[model samples]
Target: METILSATGLLTPGVEYGRVAPLADDADPVKAVGAVVPVQTHSLNVGVLTEPGQSFPDTDALITRLRGVAIGVRTADCIPVLLYAPDIEAVAAVHAGWRGTVGDIVGVTVSRLEAMGADAGRIMAHVGIGICGDCFEVGSELAVCFEDAGLGAFVLPGPFTDRLTGEPMDPDRRHIDLRCANVSRLLRRGIPEANISVAPECTRCSEIAPGPCAASVAGSGMTLAVGSEGKSAARSGVRLPSWRRDHGTTRRMLTWIRLREECPS
Candidate 1:
């Protein structure tokens, strides 16, 4: 009997991306690889790559054709975009923070994948957990950044608050949705909408107070934020996100994808 322990349904049947969980001590999430998988993680400095290893540098994404080696990115309020090409057996793990979104990291990654013989129209993409637009309030400069990049629709008026005072804020300050922006990038690059999946849960709002973990909350469906949805959270007794700075927490969620070695005929 095949007892499915953790079935995320994120990847295809043969795909080997691990839906890992971070430690209870507020550390980065770790994959389910034993001492066998030749997996590698990067510092996720918002840069792109064609290699993988533990070199903690200024890179934010990784792409590789190496089988059995997992590549992952860490995030809290940032978007973790994973791409896979079944034709070429190539996989990519990207960390798309707000800055990365402005820099078109996801688009750049698609270009890199296309360079490696990956058809943008055929590749599968997944936009993982991060802050939602309603929860991610930003300054004018930050909001204009995405608008300048032709993602004006994603930049909307989100709930704004004084970061220092933690009080009600002006309704004018715009909030940016990194997930939507990245998705737009993928669409602009010719990736089919049917080939992409976006996780609808907001990192800050998904956590339930004295309740279920990410798996359970995700098992349900919710998308709220810290300050913006305080009343709702208090009423529902929701927990704060792991790495949500708004909740005064420090932790990261890991998103990974790997290419399994082809079997010998």
Candidate 2:
């Protein structure tokens, strides 16, 4: 069955957030939630929404202080980050692919939130599912981009084994941990370590439901062992979509966030 993995519980009381894997031809889930979603260009531009149903072109991040108006980003394998600042009653949804990460999109989002009367120390972040370092093999040029941006630690030496089939990649390929790179950005912006929650699933290897279809779609693979920073091991049998695994599949998982009209005491 189709499902949405919720992270609202990981955030403050007045926030709602989740990631949903839609069927190949399902309608837009953002519309179903009455939220605004940007037309992304894989750029660094962030849209600041002031009203319900607002959208912008070439936007990969979204921020809003409006109550009851949700914001979201669609991704196949890129990381989705949801942020909330209770003190300012503001929220942001960011889509950080490799290019966005190299450009420090999460850092840019946090700075924007801080400018809007938000305290970085009080902001809570939920880093959603994406391609894991083990599965994301890249060329040296892309790896150097992260290294030059001072995120070199998240980039690993290659001679990688495919996370799905355990086959060796080119010895010279490199892997980057997009999730931790963005987490480092959040920490650098002053959000406490305890204020962040990371989704441990790797979209490429996190299989769909168990069945003949799953058997056909997923291969025998080793599970990803996440870091010791309060993260769980990556599990299988969740229905999240992946552009890399599916080879340019149009299906996307929508990660969304909204502020509640009433805060619970």
Candidate 3:
């Protein structure tokens, strides 16, 4: 079971992390490693774990210092963030959607980890695959919410422009940069710039276009129907079961992280 990315570089020497592909649900190996998954409710809740295999309800993030205990979150298009603090031996797995981003879930998670003696400056963060800025079209109101939250730089107005050509697009398509917003939040919390690594893959268009573009996936079954269908990943078009791409597909990608159990020599 090859993962999208091993993410070994994202953490210190003792932690392991990866984002699972959609097809591997039946044989997910992380569960065998004491994976503690939460019942996500798209909120700002963060669960603190003291043991492995414990479940939390309505949580979008999980953090723990327990060794050998893997914590994870499920997602379709929302961002999956993994954090580690080598100094304190702490780890966290976060699920950030538009809702969680606006509420500053990652910031709160960092605060919680700090409460456990972890230093924000030494914390390593990995912002995994999710909707990219250009592909994530949003309503003006939503854009304003991000702006109000001090994330105005990441918002692009309707009639989106081509990142490659700078050409204007549909008059009705405003967009927000979830990744940039999260990274901004991370930096504001004193997580050093060099310590944060963000995956470039966009769950929506990375698979559908040569370059990620929302217009490419707009009306395609790979995304919500443009006009009639509502708004909304994989290679060849989408390797994961994107809720927007699959049009309400129940399937999801599991993002997990664990502090490795010591190997006996």
Candidate 4:
């Protein structure tokens, strides 16, 4: 598993696992590794996040103030976000696919952390595995979300030709850089640039590509299918999958942003 390290200043460090699925129900969900294990096993004795006989709820994020509690997010293509606030010693793990991104869940989490007494600067954020801008092709309407989020410039003109196909990318087809968008959001929230880091890998482009590139196509297809069903279906159709879909990419990107107070002189 590829993991990113934290910059020296923040004491609460985290690792983002690329291409790894949360242990299936048959697997142990709570085995902590690295810094998270000691917290999970010794200090905070909590059950694994998954529940028996129920699909993990459509929860795209988890936050814990319990030291040694390891919070994990599973992603095939969607972005997994990990946040740590050294001052309060709290950590949050988030899953941001297009809907979550547009909903601005990351910013919401940041606000929640602040409400919990975490200084925005003392918080170190890591945006993990997901599809990249070039690899993600969506519609103009979808593209507007990023623009609305202030990352419009990252959108490139396309017929973003598919790496596998020479066909012109659809006009409705918009390529999204989930990581860049999130990083932009973090910076806009006043998180310093030097405090932020991004992974260079694209799940779609990696050997561990989460699923068939067509998974996005399938997801979009499903959205369209749901739209045909009814108004409610249409409204819900636009939402991103809460769990792993397709064989989506799994390469994790680990980067960090630290607050001024937490920064090392």
The TM-score leader among the candidates is 2
- Name the candidate, 1 or 2, with the larger lDDT value: 2
Candidate 4 residue-wise lDDT, 1-265, digit = tens? 1232322322233322222332122222232222221121111112223322222344556566554334565454677677777777666766677777766777877887788888898677767646767678777788887788667876777667654345665766767777888887787776676666554444454332232222343422211111111112222223222222234322222221222223333
Clashing pairs in 2: none
Quality of model 2 by C-alpha lDDT: 0.77
Q: Which stretches of candidate 2 lie above 4 Å from their native place? A: 1-9, 208-236
- Candidate 4 matches the true fold with a TM-score of 0.61
Q: What is the lDDT of candidate 3?
A: 0.72
Winning candidate number (lDDT): 2
lDDT by residue for model 2 (120-213), tens: 9999998887999988888889988999999999998776788788888778788999999999999999999999988777888765443222
Report the alpha-carbon TM-score of model 2 versus the true structure: 0.85
Candidate 1 wrongly placed segments (more than 4 Å): 1-10, 26-28, 31-56, 158-169, 208-248, 261-265
Q: TM-scores across all candidates?
A: 0.72, 0.85, 0.80, 0.61
Flag clash pairs in model 1: 45-59, 46-60, 47-60, 207-239, 208-239, 209-238, 209-239
Return the lDDT, model 1, position 113: 78
**Backbone atom clashes (below 3 Å) for every candidate:** 7, 0, 6, 14
Distance (Å) between predicted and true CA of 253, model 1? 0.7
Native-to-model Cα distance after best TM-score fit, residue 148 in candidate 2, in Å: 0.8
